[model samples]
Target: MNDYENMSDEQLVQLSLEDQDCFYYLMKRYDIKILRYIKRLTTISQEEAEDIIQEVFIKVYRNLNGFNRKLKFSSWIYRIAHNEIINQYRKTKLRLAMIPSNIEDQANLIDSINDTIEINGAYENLEKDERVRKALAELPDKYREILVLRYLEDKSYDEISDILRKPPGTVATQINRAKTSFKKIAGRHQLNTGIVK
Candidate 1:
């Protein structure tokens, strides 16, 4: 009967430490987001992604006492999930792929990229464009994951820096480089319907 929805992540962490049931709120909050993050970073099935998420939540709970309140909770949790994803890839040698399953999500990613790169597009029509998706998959793992974190996941530079454990300048540079790489790939795929600059 607690209004867990009204509580911030830090508060939930504190409560969860004292009352384990409160941990469910934290898991409930990030479960889907972390699952999608795993799926976006690799060609993993829902079952596999869910398994990774379970592991992520378990790690988060175990490390709750060590959670740095200075950092945003979302960033901290994502850092754990990112590490787990890397571990999974190392274990399974999964094909690295960025899977933006939702049409709206894909369009939002395209729009965000367009805004960041100053592309001259009002309508990208990327929802039905397999080439765009293919272009995304062709990017290097670093670039693809950065794009997902920046655009799709809507993480800020500092948040990304924390999640990736890179310097803020490094995250900014990687994001810029990722944008350039994506543009080049999109060009090769003839996806410049309204791209500019």
Candidate 2:
């Protein structure tokens, strides 16, 4: 497979520390996966997602010296990404608070509609995809992250647990809970559209 896959973590880390190209290679391996995770969490404009992705990578690169070999590299990068997204969300909240109440609501509503439309267009059938995306959007971050990593990203429970720093049993339980929540939201949406269960 990939060079990194064959190399020991210690070797990769050593290479990354010594060479900028090695760091770039590491970023190339993980960037899209991390970006997809961030996008699902933020549900914001693409520009905002790009900005956060840069911030996350920067943090990861700068902090490489401190990385522990005991942890999986993917987990470490995702942890950085998760923190960056939370920071961005807080910043967004403060900015929204500074705006007029009516304007803030309207802006959020428009953004929601745009997100819905974008997600809808990605699927072959608009209504079902919209329902699914809306359901996903409703999930709490903890549940949503696990669900997306498990189902959408096709990661095993062990991988998800590592990424989230949770036990495998906890990841399994959270995924089940998230699926139940998603089904409820989907069922309600389908009923509203006259789609029979």
Candidate 3:
């Protein structure tokens, strides 16, 4: 068994500085995560997502020394990924798709407006998943990004703050506002908001 497998990110980073091979461990650790993140944030196919992941890791490698130890390594990596995604968007004007895209079982979206939008069986028959996807697609980039980070990626407020470079308070505010906007969109779709009577 290789002790490298158990080494912390910081440890791997230090070792990587001494031995280029150690950097591969860091890339292995985050390859899938970065790929999924890119896929979620862009409508690009898996092939394109893979290419983006390569670019993200390359940037990570080049800027490895610039990494801020004060932040969670994962957060810093994600910030890099986020910036790369934005750059691609600027060039192509692409947008993110819903992640963990189980419309049928989307707990976060459902739970957000579950109070006001009761999902009765009759309403549930109205293709709620498609409706939710549409509503999410309609959301502005900032709102969607927060929801994805908090819900899909399952990141903590502090982690989100680190990645977005926003205060936790601001992240919370954005989430609340995103939920409110989502509720309005869901209502418009008539996904059985119970108020459609």
lDDT of 2 by residue, 64-173 (tens): 89987787787778778877877877777512111112333324432333333332223345455445556555667677566556545567887777777789898888
Per-residue error (Å), model 2, residue 187 = 3.7
Q: Which of 1 and 2 is ahead in lDDT?
A: 1
In TM-score terms, candidate 3 sits at 0.85
**For candidate 1, what is the TM-score?**
0.86
What lDDT, from 0 to 1, does candidate 2 have?
0.63
lDDT of 3 at 30: 97
> Per-candidate TM vs. native?
0.86, 0.67, 0.85
Q: Return the candidate ranking by TM-score, descending.
A: 1, 3, 2
Model 1, 1-197: lDDT tens per residue? 45899999999999999999999998999988888888777777888888889899999999999999999999999999999988888898765675565567667776676666543334346432566677776788898788889888989999999999999999999987887888888778766634343
Name the lDDT of candidate 1: 0.82
For candidate 1, the 10 contiguous residues with the lowest summed lDDT are 119-128
Clashing pairs in 3: none
In terms of TM-score, which candidate is strongest? 1
